[model samples]
Target: MAKWTTENPAFVDTWFSLFRLGQTKKQFNAADTIKMSELTFFNPLSSKDNLKIEATLIADTIDKVFSSWGAKLENSISRNTAINDMIQILLDEDKTIKDLAEKNDENYFFTNEIKLENES
Candidate 1:
């Protein structure tokens, strides 16, 4: 994606909001995907447009990652730029996770459900 700029003010605003939502939510659902679909340049579900496809992927990812894990900062850029930055961040995170998995067994990070002992 091209660098995000202020030229697309609407996209910028929407992304900013989605980014913030990631911080407060434990997980996003299909409803969130529908909401972010509003950012698409065309009808994402029905249209085969490239912009629409990109928009759908972005929305799906936002929902999947819970809004960039609330890592959005006050950076000035256009929609494309924002997308680029987000992809970069996610890639970086993936790399770290992969490294950790390689260091330990595949289930290294997968543990059983948390158990809380009685405080009383």
Candidate 2:
């Protein structure tokens, strides 16, 4: 799984809480709190959209953090390429498995259980 090391747990918790409240209460304003938390976390350094300025700052902060850890964005992209390649291979294999299941009258299993079994 891809990891984001600089993610703030408290911020995430609050974001989720706001999202859940918005869903349960059907209040559109609850999204404002979530958006604010996102802006606080992803403040970009430069952005054309004033609404996204905070997010730009946060992105700049994350870039700096990654640089300090010796993992720049380019290196992260390279790593992600490898991960995507692996995912594509797995998806192809899953298609093959589904074909076999269809042929055998077992139907195609698309659940986590099947994926975990295939992995093992």
Candidate 3:
């Protein structure tokens, strides 16, 4: 099985923490200060089935979070440029997508829609 892990787990946690804070404030204190590396995702895609599991896991997380807070979230992740870029980062790479399509020990994918919905 593949797992989604980040070298900077604290960064990820803090990022989400800010998001929650923004939710309370009705606006992010420093929107422009937030960032994620193009290569933020760290995982070993050992097989297509495993990768699918990872993607599905990501999707499920989003579904659970967004479904609960859909109104507050307003569901803007799909239209986000960062999300699109992350998808591209997954799809544009023949190696990554192919590995994701089947399975490669070294593949990375970032799901923006999957990322946001779960944060709520």
Best by TM-score: 3
Write the residue-wise lDDT of candidate 1 on 4-95 in tens digits.
33333223333444446442131222222232223223243453455445544653454344234332322354445445544333233222
Residues 27-116 of candidate 2: C-alpha lDDT, one tens digit per residue: 332332222323222234434354244323333343333335343223234434433332332223122212211221121122333455
C-alpha lDDT of all candidate models, in order:
0.33, 0.30, 0.32
- Return the TM-score for each candidate structure: 0.22, 0.25, 0.29
Say which candidate scores most in lDDT. 1
Q: Could you arrange the candidates by lDDT from highest to lowest?
A: 1, 3, 2
Task: Put down candidate 3 lDDT per residue, 54-119, tens digits, no spaces.
Answer: 434443343344335431222333324322333343433232321221121122122443465589
Of 1 and 3, the candidate ahead on lDDT is 1
Task: Name the weakest run of 10 consecutive residues (lDDT summed) in model 1.
Answer: 107-116
Please list the residue runs of candidate 2 whose C-alpha ends up more than 4 Å from where it truly belongs after superposition.
1-48, 74-120
Segments of candidate 3 deviating more than 4 angstroms? 1-42, 72-120
Residue 54 shift from truth in candidate 2, angstroms: 1.2
